[model samples]
Target: MIEFWISAGLLCLIAMGFLLLPSLRRNRARAEEDRTAVNVALYEERVQALEEQHQAGVLDEPGLQTAQDEAARELLADTDGDAGRQRVRGRVVPMLAAVCVPVLGLLLYAKFGAIGAVEQARTAAEAPGTIEQITARLERAVRERPESSQGWYFLGRTLIAEGRAADAAKAFQRAAETGGRAPAVLGLWAQALYFAGDKQWSPQLDALTDEALAADPSEASTLGLLGIHAFDERRYADAIGFWEKLLAIMPAGEPSRQGIERSIAMAKAQMDQRSNAQDAPTPAKGIRLRVALADALQQQVRPNDAVFVFARAVDGPPMPLAVKRLRVADLPAEVSLSDTDAMMPELTLSAFEKVELVARISRAGDAQHGEWIGREQGAPRAEQALREVVIDALDKGASGNER
Candidate 1:
């Protein structure tokens, strides 16, 4: 700015020289013309005095005439002495050119000069270039405007972005102290405290988050931070709950939606794993069996045929509660069906009080039906012995009643 003012002042001086120097020259010329007129007046006064002397009879007509001629010659000499001033007289055209030169220069400068661009460039040169410098500037701004909640909040956020969580927590505390009790401010303050405490979920964090959520139930930052906290503490179900709420409130076309959904999926998987682990110690349920083709039906079955061993609720849905499969060559092999082998979460062997075991030989390797089958009915037991099953007859369901 100083440089700008200095250069502007210099240009103004140059313009004044163009404008005022011409007027100064004209004033000097006017002074010279006034001096010439004074000389002519003095000569006229001398000629009048000589005529008066002749009238008083002090000189003849020739003496008076000679004196007048001498006075006229003296006036001519005086005019000739200032010949340069008369030759180069000041004119209206020169004065107009003097004024126009400065005016046109100013107009051209305004049209062509990039003053705004230059000023921006100068500002950029003095801009902060490092984290420390920016932090210092932000701190200064906050200090200068102590009542400005926005400035303090922005400074806190900037400190957090720089990974200075401890310092950021202090800044956020200051903001919370000075700022309105808005949900965003409270959420941000809680988030900073959560990180500052090494991701621990403390009572202070809970209170802050509660306040934030009480004000704005859908505050995403608080919800996200809570989810992260629960996940870090191995509370996967809690994490899923918080993240699902966050997902529900998120606007359409948000870029982080996919990432948040992925996080929720991962949390759900972790939740399932935790459930499985908790259930591992509980008593197991299901049946054990050994299946084979009867000796009498040896020639009726092929070695490459597939065998399926399964159980289903006797009076409930026909879908298998659990199942295992093998090739005919591996028949007579023992197998167990347990809740651990359930096909789906909602369906398990332990869910039923009674089930029927069915073993079948299907050349097509399908469990739905087979060319031959054998069956037994019993209560689903957790620690039962392997009961022998022999397939010796044709599947009679095709002939009459479907089993």
Candidate 2:
């Protein structure tokens, strides 16, 4: 607030100074103009006096000649009076001082009055990824650059992440005040409000998502969350529609695609089961096996070095279902696989039957084989199922197929 007042005062001072500038300049020019005109008139009078003396025969030839020479010398002396023009140009100093004073004062005022260094130092004291760190940095960034709506949006998100719901809402409101609503900001702000327990703001989520969809309907996060919301409301058809639309937009094998795939599977299963109860023939439901390596290692589902799961028919393209990466902290004596399903978003195993299955943890950002299963009938029953695949494949000499 103090900074605002100081800036306002400085701006007013600058405005007033500029307003006074042209008047002062015109007055100075007028003074120079009057003096120049007076000097020219005086020179003319002196020449007229000399001419009259010569005409009146006030002196002989030598005297007239001497008088004429004196007049010429006086004319030369008056030439020095033209220095007034230099004085007019010298007005530049005042003009420059007029400009410099306000600007310099602004700089000095900012240096001394604004809390820049203090904010920067405070921001630096915070560590990345920590709530405190994010908060301090966010505050400092907003303070330093209040005009940046993007920065405000980021600060709002940080505030939300830190659980400062009221502050986050205010920050988001300020970001919107900039009259530039980025889709990411709108979506995030809606999420923040949702987390803050304001169901009224829920519609904003749809509005924002719709706006984003207008640009790129395939945006995964937007579609995924909206689909989830629809499914939560028991709107299975709506959920399926959203998921399918998202599926069409997403790349094959993308995590989002997997999620959409699972939702689709679940929705279809529900629909088919409903139809079956109504005396309809049960349609076949395909299986999609997705194995995700989750462990204390690399953190859970980090897509680090954890194994990826893939299942394909003995003679089909290897369909990649899911990638699970672990972190160094996540490594433990045992790795557990949870939430494995044919129709789940993270993995899809039902896509193939009578398949060759492989589970491998690789650091190379892609799935590889650490365990191999031949003719596996169903999803792994336990963590041992994952580990035993290696044993069975080795015992059967199926290891000869690939490393």
Candidate 3:
């Protein structure tokens, strides 16, 4: 937040500085143009007067010569003097302003802002989640209890993990029916619907959320759904209200709190975008996936090492996403997954429809899991899907579905 202000203030100062220098330079140029025109006219008039005097026999050759020399010398002195003075003035102000603007911006940011903390928060936001460990546990849990709705929920989450939006939506639907409509179920359903880009199903999502909200007003998931719906519909005030309610319910440093804060920022940004239609600015639309090793789990590898990161078309053959390989020792304890990573080709919120991410710590070592960081459950849906595939494979092998 503080960084935003500092950046905003710096940008304003830059714009102001640009405006000031150009206007001043224009004024100075106009002044020089005016002076040059006046000086030329004076010289022409003096020469005409000299010609008239000579024609009227009012002056001798020497007098005319002396008058011409005086006029030319005067013109040279005046023009040079004015040019030097304007040059000195013009060069000085812009240079002084250039130095002062950024300095002033720094001082203002230091005195009245939260730039450092905001940057730290932003950095935290960029860190990758420990999804693999969670996915592993969720996978284990669902295997242990195949009939549990918790397992279904976990499976839906894994479908989401694999970027299988449509499948995740179906799984979430099942989870909701089995659990009698949990807030998490409703939230995930709504998110899946939203990501699927089908407006026709939104009314159902809205109804589900209404019921969920009635059951628990402080439910962060439902509140998030409301906020998202409001944001999507351009109801900024409503969205802000919902997000604020969510923030009030959540303690600082919680995931819900951070998510709500991001929503608020995005909501306000959308508001600003609407207000500035003439500007035609576009927000960043990109996604990044980073893979890293846990420090506590690392036996011999350095924490700062780089790791391989890749992505593929969710529905196609495992084509690698464009990225460079870095050693596992180059990255911090947490890796950042973002669009800027070279591995992300055509990165956008909608680009990933279904993808399998594999991160190997080493050829022989166990790869860190994805899909379990914030999600407490393993992917039950994935396990079920795997089972179905296995059965299908067996049936194909047997040439029929008959047991």
Candidate 4:
């Protein structure tokens, strides 16, 4: 910034030189012209007076000639060294203008120029060559602009990449607070917290994921995190469910799609292997329900709209014990929710004595919030069979009002 000002000042001086130099030279030329005119007038008057004196018989031809010679000599003497003696006037205004030009230019620039942006660009151009340098720069930036959510988020991501999970978590938390707890920000914060705790699951992490999903059920980061957690815990079915939802929302040709697909296949394989190894007869400890959209709302929903069928404990946690995702086009479909469909190993449908079954139509594919809903009138036993749920009621506060 100082360098920029110095260069600007030099350029201004050059411009002022261009303006003032010409005016000073013109003033000097005008003064010389004025002195020449006065000398010429004085010579003319002396010659005329000599003619008048000679015509009046006051002097002879020789005397007049000598007088004219004297006049010419006097004129030469008067004009001698006049160029050096004469002072060029009218220079004050030009000098003042020369000084004011730069001052006024600086004032206008201060009012309208983007000096701060210029400095930022200059700083960015000198990119940090190492991770440590980059980290330090980001730290400084966040300190200077604490309200900048993006700055904090990038800093968090950088820290995560550098294997500083605990610091990353703190950065992500700050990002979430400054960013209005946006779904993506919350998801990242939860992920950082999970890794910071050495992959140990906690209620705080769960709450963060829940809040993020409540805002945007299709948030990819939260889904991915949950899937990974389930997979690590050997909850193959739950992992498959979470990964499948994430896969559906991911764009085609995404680089991460292939990995997620591989994960889903592995989870499915694990589930099959476990099922095949079981020797004991598995009793029917599950709920069977048929779900269908109402005839009146058929026009309001699209064929590809998401349909979520789940069971939640009647007097327990708000999260679903078991969940199955379907589409509106597959409505009037029968789904069975059992321990195999549990979202968590300890929170299976059979673990909840009394549960409420619900079917929701979410055009945005959000399981937590939907456009319409239907549920069983009262809490029913987990093994209740062949119940029917109709999607007939408007869902106001879909997840929150489910109690």
Candidate 5:
């Protein structure tokens, strides 16, 4: 910011020089004109005396001619070879303009220029470039602004990138304490804690991931962490389920897509191998439900509208345990909610003994809120018989149905 102001001051000086130079030259020219006028007045007086002597007959024609010639010689010798001068112009206008130019420029700039943005840009350009330098800067920043959530958050992210997960966890904790506990922040905090614990699963880490997913089911970091945990535990099917959801929400052409896809394929291969083994575990049966829009609310929905069917634990986090998406046209559709449809690996349908089944119709395709919704009033066993969920009511701030 200081450098920017110094450069701007220099440019202003250059501009002032342009405005004042011509005025300075004009003042010098006026002084020269005044000297010329003095010389002309002296010459005219000498010529007038010569003419008076001739008229008085004190000099004959030849004598007067010699005198006039001598006077002309003296006049020419005194004046030298200089151009005739014009009347001097007033200096007030030019001087006033020279003074006003810089002042007016400053005033206009103050009114219209993006001075704050310029300062911000300069600050950003001069920011620490290397990871170590940035980490140091962020550490200092957090210390100075202890209540700044953004500072703490970035510090945590930098620490994580610098391979200091324990320090990162503390930083993330500070960030959350400073009111930066958004889903992304929570996910990153959980990730840092998980890695700092040598990838060990703990109740605290589980709660963090669950809290993040409760806020936003599609939080990428939490989903990725869960998938990695499941895969490491040899829960290949669960890992595949988690990674598939992660893969679906990831933007196309992402640089990390290939790595995630490879992981998914590996998990699937492992699952296939385990299924072919003689000691394979039987797959757990999940709840089955038939969903259909009520006749009264049918006109309020479109064929292309999204339909979400899911189950959530009766007394657990708000995030869905298992979810399946379909279009309104697919209803009266039959869908199954199982571990394979789990939103997160650890939060599968079978993990909870009793769960509530819900169906919703959303025109905007958001699973959290919908125009019409239906659900079973009582919690049922995970392996309950196939049931029908009629989309019969308006979803007006409905509880326990949020994704």
Candidate 6:
């Protein structure tokens, strides 16, 4: 900045030099004009003296005429152009200008020029190699001119890039205020405030974002922030709903399209999982398995015995994620355990990373305790081909207790 001012002062001096130097130095044209004026004055004085001498009888008419002719010749020799024309005068104006021009320039700059802005611009041009320096300049600019909403907005963005959400929120707020609560500005301000509060939602932020969306329903940032917040709070349906709205408004080939799509997919999976937990058995969103009694166990199994086909988390509470019931007579049948078939309101196939399938034949028809069971364990996924669960093992206590 100092270097900038130094250069600026030097340039001003150089310009003033150009403007004032010619006035101080004598030029050929002015010298000729001066010489012509001097010669004309001398010629008039000599001609008057010769006429006085002739009138006093000290010189004849011819002498007076000869002296007058000599004076005219001298005048002609000294002058270049018409002798009647007047020469421009007064060094006072140029001298005054030379003396007062720099002062006047300084006064004008003090009144209307942006000294700080000029210095900042000059310094940036001279040394803009670091982000910190650039950011500092931006900060100073916005601070100096609070009404510069665009400048403030960019400063806020830079602050966010610097991971200063708290500071960025302040800048964004200023920008929104200065920028007349513009939709994008307000939405971004809300986002910055949200992060500054450690991702906690506030009524103020909610109001801000709502207002922004009201102004522009297709505002992507507000929708995206809302969706992300919902997803983080496990409100998958709300998350999906918000993201779906954003998706509808997003342009084709949007740079953020993939991220939003992934979020939407995950939210949908969570929503489907929750929905399945509270619904009835349906394979539309579940896994399918074929339960069959082994040929050797066929003779031991009773046709009227209850057969329970279910899926449970591999390492979770001892509750079925989904379950189906049938009779032993229905052996070699395909059964489905899905979100709709969840045994509890909080358990579903999609919620668990892994689950085991079991086909149990219970003589007493108790779900918790079974006589003989066939088991298959792996990741639970909706598959067209049925996974086989054959009842082949003897009940550890069923036959023993019967005996």
lDDT of each: 0.80, 0.59, 0.62, 0.87, 0.82, 0.80
Candidate of highest lDDT: 4
For 1-403, candidate 2 gives per-residue lDDT tens digits of: 4655577777767785687678777876776677667766776787678778778987667876787678767665665555555566657756777677767867987878755655566556656977777778778778887887877888887887778876886788678767476555555555566556644436566677787667665666567667777777767888998888778876776765676688789988887877778897543343333342333322423334444444444544444432234332343323333335342463444444444555545444434334322233444332233332221232122222452
Better of 1 and 5 by lDDT: 5
Ranking by lDDT: 4, 5, 6, 1, 3, 2
Deviation from native of the Cα of residue 191 in model 6, angstroms = 1.4
TM-score to true structure, per model: 0.47, 0.36, 0.33, 0.53, 0.41, 0.50
lDDT by residue (tens digit), candidate 3, 37-140: 89989999999999899889998999999999999999988899889988898888878877787778779878998755565456546544677655555555
Task: State candidate 6's TM-score.
Answer: 0.50
Model 1 CA deviation exceeding 4 Å by range: 1-3, 14-36, 50-155, 170-182, 201-207, 282-403
For model 5, what is the C-alpha lDDT against the true structure?
Answer: 0.82
Tens digit of per-residue lDDT, candidate 5, span 21-103: 78678876776677668877877787788778889987778987887688778667654544332222335555676678768
Question: Candidate 5: where is the Cα deviation over 4 Å?
Answer: 1-123, 279-403
Report the error of model 1 at residue 365, Å: 49
Report per-prediction Cα RMSD to one decimal: 13.8, 17.9, 31.5, 19.6, 20.6, 16.1
Give the alpha carbon lDDT tens digit for every residue of 228-307 in model 6: 89999999888988999999988898999899999999988888888888795643467778888888887787889998
What is residue 294's positional error in candidate 3, in angstroms?
Answer: 64
Candidate 4 per-residue C-alpha lDDT over 1-403 given as tens digits, one digit per residue, 9 for 90 to 100: 8999999988998887897788778877887788878997999999999999999999899999999999999888777656756543445666787778988998999999988668767877897998887888788789877999999999998898888989999998999889899999889888888888989999999899999999999999999999999999999989999999999999998999999999999999998888887965775478888998889998898999999999888888888888999999998899988888988987887776788889988889899999999988545674456888999999987664656
lDDT of residue 348 for candidate 2: 47
Per-residue lDDT for 122 in model 5? Answer: 58
* Reference-based lDDT, residue 65, model 6: 85
Instruction: Rank by TM-score, highest first.
Output: 4, 6, 1, 5, 2, 3
Candidate 4: where is the Cα deviation over 4 Å?
Answer: 1-14, 50-82, 85-112, 125-148, 170-180, 200-204, 232-234, 265-403
lDDT of 1 by residue, 1-403 (tens): 6898578768866876787778767886787879888998898889889989999999899999888888888888888877655546545545666678667766887899777656656754787888777787778767766887877888888898899888887887778788777788888888888888888778888899999999999999899999998888888888989999999988889999999899989988888888898988775644778887788878888888888888778777777778788888887788888987777779888888877788888887777767998877655454357776788878755211346
Q: C-alpha displacement of 202 in model 1, angstroms?
A: 4.7
